[model samples]
Target: MPTALKLTTVQGNSLPIPGVESWHVTAKDPAMLVMTDFHWHSSVTVSENSTIDAALDHMKHTGVRCAFVIDGKMSAVVGMITAYDISGEKPVQHMRLTSTPRNEILVKDIMQKMADWHVANLKDIESATVAEVLKVFTDSDVTHIPVMEKNANNEQRLRGLLSFAKVKRLLVA
Candidate 1:
């Protein structure tokens, strides 16, 4: 005979996403929120061909909601994958857009392409304090922003990533 399983519950206060709306800034002190001051989402990455399930696993272990989709080893960051991208309507949209079955969908299919994402310039990120990066969140519907840096070749390279959660957590605190 086996013993019955047991579970317990814990309670805590919740942090709310700042700003009344996507374009609004309801935080009392937006200046205290700097993208650099917060953690960026560039550490964990996944291949574009990885399945949504795989991306989810990576995020789960990394404690991040987003992953930069890399093409290959040391490759330029191509796209981004987030929990929302997988758990949200993106998969359904991908199915509709590509006529692919749910099982056939890959991260690449639903990832926000490089061309579709707006980024903060590395220089601006280095110089700007406060929640200037909040505008990136406000201007777009995305919770993450891929920051780009222009290198010696005058080409934009993947620098880091910013997310709305980090900004809002600090701002609302």
Candidate 2:
């Protein structure tokens, strides 16, 4: 008759291997998983000629929360402003749409200056892991991160944008 193999128990379960230790391994998805193959272009942009009211109107029409202030020269990415910046404090009755035109109020007049904003270049973003992105979101006040890339001419171009919402979803997923 064949001999029966002996079994060992741990926490009321039989061990797969007798006299060998068992371990539980936890795995995490890397930052690459969060990156999408199809880039979602952020069309929310305005020129220096654009007024606060016009920008706000454009934002409302497009359902975008923020607008990027752009100029033809070098794509400096001067600044960005949101609807909350305008309406957060002012009451609805006090908010002026028609009376206060956009041309009259240049984007620079209302945009949160670059000096006051936190900037993260594309290289910086590419090097940053999902955990680092989460740390940035938790540590900073800004919601959007501008992703910059170098063009064929070797000039920096604004490639895309990263939002806190996307980062959070990726981390949790």
Candidate 3:
């Protein structure tokens, strides 16, 4: 048998901890308020072939309004899908156009293709303020903005994403 492990008992009922400093985000704050930085957080993703219902379920379970749709090999994002896309008129349009049943509709069928996405350069976003980001959101009437950066290979890679809902929740201006 191995040696017995030692366990320490509590020496006091209370421990001292530093108090958190409170701060409110303002329109002049860093654009990070509107962005989900991929470096610190994972993006919600779903297979392109997944049924719209399944994709919507995954988004609901993850508490995210948008997700990147990855291709079969899961090596590339071919499109984007949002809660609106899954629940909005896109589904009905696709069904009518393709004569497919609602249950058989796939994320790729209603998703906005990568080529159609309006994106922001990571470099531009790095220096942008919350107010500027909000302006882009309002002017473009877009709910999501995918941030891109060039990797060492000189190929553009998805870096982060900006969400209008997130910005609205954190915006003080």
Superior candidate under TM-score, 1 versus 3: 3
Give me the displacement of residue 150 in model 3, in angstroms: 0.8
Could you arrange the candidates by TM-score from highest to lowest? 3, 1, 2
Off by over 4 Å in 1: 1-42, 72-74, 97-99
How good is model 2 by TM-score? 0.57
Total residue pair clashes for candidate 1? 0
- Model 2 over residues 58-166: C-alpha lDDT tens digits? 8899866677787757365777777765555332323364354434665566677666766566666666677776677789877766666777899866666656665
Q: Which stretches of candidate 3 lie over 4 Å from their true place?
A: 1-24
Write candidate 3's Cα lDDT for 11-130 as tens digits: 989766653443457899888656889988999999999999999999999999999999988998999999998888999999899999999999989998999999999999989999
Clash counts per candidate, in order, are 0, 1, 0
- Extract clashing residue pairs from model 1: none
lDDT of 1 by residue, 17-116 (tens): 6744433234444432344332343378899888888889889998889888888564767888889989999899888988998887898889988888
Candidate closer to the true structure by TM-score (higher is better), 2 or 3: 3
Each model's C-alpha lDDT? 0.74, 0.62, 0.91
Give candidate 2's whole-model lDDT.
0.62
